[model samples]
Target chain A: MIEVAGGRLIAELTVRRPSFTLDVSLEVAAGELVAVLGPNGSGKSTLLGALAGLLRPDTGRIELDGRVLTDTTAGVHVPAHRRRVSLLAQQALLFPHLSVAANVAFGPRCAGVGRAAANEQARGWLAEVDALELARRRPGQLSGGQAQRVALARALAGEPELLLLDEPLASLDIDVAPAMRSLLRRVLRGDRGGGDRGGNAVGARTALLVTHHLLDAVVLANRVVVLAEGRVVEDGPAREVLTRPRSPFAARIAGLNLIPGTGCAEGLRTHDGTLVSGLLDAGVSGLLDAGESDSWDGAPAVAVFAPSAVSVFRQRPDGSPRNVFAVRLAALEPHAEVVRLRVSAPPGGPDWLDGLAADISPAAVADLGIGDALGDVLWFAVKATEVLAHPSVH
Target chain B: MVGVGLPVVLWAPAVLGFALVALPVVGLVLRADLVRLPELMTSEEALTALKLSLFTAAVSTLLTALLGGPLAAVLARSRSAAVRLARPVVLLPLVLPPVVGGLALLYTLGRTGPGGRLLELWFGVTVPFTTAAVVLAQTFVSMPFLVVSLEGALRTAGERYERVAATLGAAPATVFRRVTLPLVLPGLGSGLVLAFARSLGEFGATVAFAGSLEGTTRTLPLLVYQQREVDTDGAIALSLVLVVVAVVVVAVARPRVAEGAQ
Candidate 1:
């Protein structure tokens, strides 16, 4: 039996649909803002649905703050309203017919709070979100950011055990995101609340934010769980994962190149059996802390580094770097300030090392005489200090 | 707009149909005994029928809303095949001839039908030829209007807001009361007015199922029909009252601005 943590949420859920199957397991510790990051159709919304009780999982268990919200095995299920969870979606979803004050008061009112007390609580939350002035206004009249502020206030007024935010900032204007981001940071950090903000009777005011924007995680979340195709692909401390991603999708979002392999004391041998003999940076070297006996046991690992770390050479001109691979240009496309060359893997590579992309200047392309639809064989190398090798995430 | 001047013969029938609808109302107004309208309407028969009509129609509208609300909500939210089939089936009375609807109501609640026989045998209640029968006939035909209108509004409003409310700690009943009801108020209002008007003008059903009894089941429409044969002046005078009700119905039910474009 798993011991439950107070103010903690643990879910091992498998929700089945005709077109989608979301199977994931995770734990959110007390006061932790965990961002469920994923691209579209990645089951980010589905996970929120299951947690919020809008959609029931076929077989699983979900426990929040040591209380079971759902347990299919035991046939125990709580309704959404009774679970004390609050959800804020991309749209503010403020009740259009209700005034902003009434909208925020709705949750408390439903919880059997007296109307006056509920309105006062609503006012308090609105003030916390800096939306007190909009209390009399209808949702249709409010701007995008203001509506979202009211929505946040409404969700907070519930004193929810778990707060689910699904792309809360996704629909805001570009000019509004920065301010909203900082406001959310303040609220999630418990800065404006009483001394025991997330520690009152309802346990912690824990939150799960589903977002595609990495910046939201960087600014608002303390932990990040990356989802791809409905699976928990990676989970780590927010800054840790953002700065040193170990999974391919996370690496892509972090704008780094990742090569999956098995780590040895020397370095990483990629899936193609090509020895990527790079000196382990401190971050990558952490995975190699084990002795030779443990190291050779063959747990998969990934070597991640920035595109700029790999230098292209006309001929094999690498004297210092041991990792040298011949590559042929597959295609060239424009990146922000540089042209990215998508190339086939090193010559003599196994079928597993499919391809990689490297950023180069237009001047560099011209200097190398790279042509449109170029098929010329080139060589690329990376110094040992650049690669961060870690145990594979997936 | 249709093509300008294709053929006169093709469009003549539509114009003639429009005229046919307009001429009767125009003739009624033209021949209205306006000067003695107050005196004619205050007569014993006219007053009884007017009061009975108002009472039955109001009661029928209330009953329609009370009974139809849950049915509309179910039809709006459920994806089951029976509900899908039954939604339009519930509106049969709306498209049905009122005389036919009245006959159906008569057989179901008359002395011989199983429900009617059981009611009389168990409770000593005879439903037909009574005020209750008038209310029932009006409800049988007009309830469909309320249901269909409310069902459309409920479907348009959708369950997203209700789901959000539920997650916000509001119980299902609370969500319906505070969220769903208020959101569908406009549709409910229109449905009520339409049902009221249908009940008011429910001549065929009232006469056939409830019978034409003065001060009991004979409503305004039945009074006007009786007056039309024996007293033209009284019929026109009573018609003016109906026209007033129709005007009020239009004023109350007409949608303003048509849509929430913003």
Candidate 2:
């Protein structure tokens, strides 16, 4: 863990609305981009509002770069405009009356910078974002993708100490999203040609991104924090959290199947007292890292595997696979190059396998004829070698 | 709905509505003394009434913008109970008879009224039967147009952009000036035009509160009313002029007024 004393942004607060309450404690190191992922109504926006100083937390403090932005105990609530933090929302929302250049220069001009210097800075930032040609155009003239590019330039031209991004690329077209993503990667990585001037080297900035797309986390963020029902359920490095998610929400986002159980000698025992054997996850250092023994007897554990690992059959498969369950074919969805079958536990069977998915090729699906067998009981089997069981902290 | 044609049954009432609004102006144009129009419209009394109407409408529209602009902004952004209650009250003049509005103004600012007595006793000022009273009466009746238009514009514009500006380090005042005002500029323009047109057509309030006096308070509408008894042809000519100006103002403001409605 990075030193909390050296953290660039520290937010530990609780916000209460009429029907919901958000309690989150997050610390972002300098120059780090952390992606926040959650389902809807998970307080993702509330967290962003608090960080942006748009909503005051009912309790706790928000400290950024040693400045106390909000401290309920001390009664110090710095307003949003004075906080030097910028937010880029899903909509570009560029000023309709101002030219693209003026929109970008709005922040600098508000900060009392000279008009000419602010325009120069805007042009520089626009060029960095590869949108210099759009300087004279009005916002109405720009396409969705172009507008988002200008929005990024405007957000960066402010030289914010911390930037909050609320699904900035979610509204773009599928074809345009990748280009916007690449532009964000370039500007965020701060590897552009220009030398560091005006203290906007870009690499020195901290950012918190909220998104629902897994690709955004894998491509843009160094770390991932998952919230569920207004609580942080999983927080780790992006790859680790995505690959070995302990929370069901994170697993769903990562498109992996997760089974909650207690650790045993081989794999784990479900709540129904069924023993499911699997190999210990080699990626998890120490296997049981919390000073626990390798036995892992009765410890909280989870078995994670890809949807492709499970094989479906109409009749009971006579195989050497160590794990098998009787499941009902719940639903079939067409994934790219494959047909995904959502299976639930059959009557008088362990319920832990409900909602687990199995991905089979289209040809295999045709051969199995499961498309005509919805709600019929089928056998789902996974080899012990395919399952990776590891200690679950929560 | 985008490419569909209107129902055949709907065209009758639509045309009837159009005729209802358009036939009166057509009648006035037909009744005007075309050969003597130039002479009658350019008469001394007609010219003075036109000048006074234009001047008072201009001042009152300015006053509406200066005062009504901020009031609309506050009404759009504020959620206080008092503001919520005051909203319909502020728009009362839009529905209230202009004569009643003039009476209310008279009771508040007339020589025998409390505010008028205060002004006379302390400041030695009398407001009734003056050019200032004409401007005030015009402002009082026309203010609701500007306020309702601007408030709709502000609400339709929403606070999302304002929030974006604030996060970009713009102070509250700067956000209002730079982001909010420019965003609602079209609405403000339409509101001002509407207010100006309403002020130009003001008659009842001016007659009741300012007491129509030639060269001082008698505006175009009042002059038309006055000349109807003495010179019917002159009244018809001046009435045609008022209708032409109203048409021009409404035409200029129609597009932006539609935008604010959205």
Error of 1 at A198 (Å): 16
Q: TM-score of candidate 1 restricted to chain B?
A: 0.89
Give the lowest summed-lDDT range of ten residues in model 2 chain A. A1-10
- The sequence of per-residue lDDT tens digits that candidate 2 reaches over residues A72-109 is 99998999999988999999999998999999999999
Candidate 1 lDDT tens digits, B1-262: 8766777676889889999988988998889787888999788899899999999999999999889888889888998998889877888998899888888888988999888999999999999999999999999899988888888888888899999999998888899999999888888888888889999999888888988989899999999998898998998889888988998887868872133111
Best by lDDT: 2
Q: How would you encode candidate 1's per-residue C-alpha lDDT over A1-394 as one tens digit per residue? A: 1222126799999987776788999999877789888777889999999999998899999999899999999997899998988899999889999999999999889888999999888888888788889989999999999999999889888888788999999999999989888778767655433453332122225889998888898877878998878888789888888777767777777877778788766668866577876556464455346434364336677777788888887898746755777888788888888988777755665543445667889899889888564677777787777876677655
In model 1 chain B, the worst 10-residue window by lDDT is: B253-262
Clashes of 1: 1
- Looking at model 1 chain A, report the run of 10 residues with the lowest lDDT sum: A195-204
B46: Cα error in model 1, Å: 3.5
Model 2 whole-model lDDT (C-alpha atoms): 0.88
Q: Residue pairs in steric clash, candidate 1?
A: A279-A384
RMSD of each: 5.3, 3.3
